[model samples]
Target: MSETTSFGDWLRPALPLLLLRLLIDEPGHGYGLVEKLRAAGISARGTTVYPHLSKLQDAGYITSHWQTPETGPA
Candidate 1:
């Protein structure tokens, strides 16, 4: 095991609530969510954020869908 605890561990308990707050006004993708958290002075990674997103989705707190860019190859 690593001796150092990641920033995620420290924030894990409150992460879901924080994430929900961020999404309340608008929908956002994973990377965007991480960026928003960082802008708010919280540091997190996909490993930290995505699992909570899954939990929220499982509990029906949020939903998601893939959006293809109009100009991108599909």
Candidate 2:
């Protein structure tokens, strides 16, 4: 495989570990987590991140709930 594909292969497995480390500090929403990962130099989109979130939830590594923002429509 090319270098880009090889890098992606490596990154895919690392995402879960990185996400768990982030969540250990505090809970966050999907978009927020994606941003945090991006800030940490991981290029992740919602499509990639959300499935891992769901897997973590399904495996009981994390939980989630909906909360309306103070200024947003509910």
Candidate 3:
């Protein structure tokens, strides 16, 4: 548990850099971003990841849009 806490402590300092890298290939939703972190060997859970997403959004390194379908019968 201590190791996990320590890693989380250390990793928060580099959040901006990692977030930049994650968005480099493509913009992603919050959950997709977490998977990208894992692919890079960073274990990012929702508690850790969402805050970083909030920070990155505040910093404007990326942007997000909700998907909409145009095939409605209306």
Q: Which stretches of candidate 1 lie over 4 Å from their true place?
A: 1-10
Q: Per-candidate TM vs. native?
A: 0.81, 0.84, 0.68
- For model 2, the stretches where C-alpha displacement exceeds 4 angstroms are 1-5
lDDT of each: 0.91, 0.87, 0.77
Where is the poorest 10-residue window by lDDT in model 1? Answer: 1-10
Clashes of 3: 0
Give the alpha carbon lDDT tens digit for every residue of 13-73 in model 1.
Answer: 9999999999999999888999999999998888889999999999999998989889966
What CA RMSD would candidate 3 show?
4.8
lDDT of 3 by residue, 1-74 (tens): 35346777878888768878878887767778788888888887878778877777788866767676688642
The candidates, ranked best first by lDDT, are 1, 2, 3
* Model 3 poorest 10 in a row by lDDT: 1-10
Give the Cα error of residue 42 in candidate 2, in Å. Answer: 0.9
Top candidate on TM-score is 2
Better of 1 and 2 by TM-score: 2
- CA RMSD of all predictions: 4.4, 2.5, 4.8
lDDT of 1: 0.91
lDDT of 2 at 72: 66
Summing lDDT over every window of 10 consecutive residues in candidate 2, give the lowest-scoring window: 1-10
Best by lDDT: 1
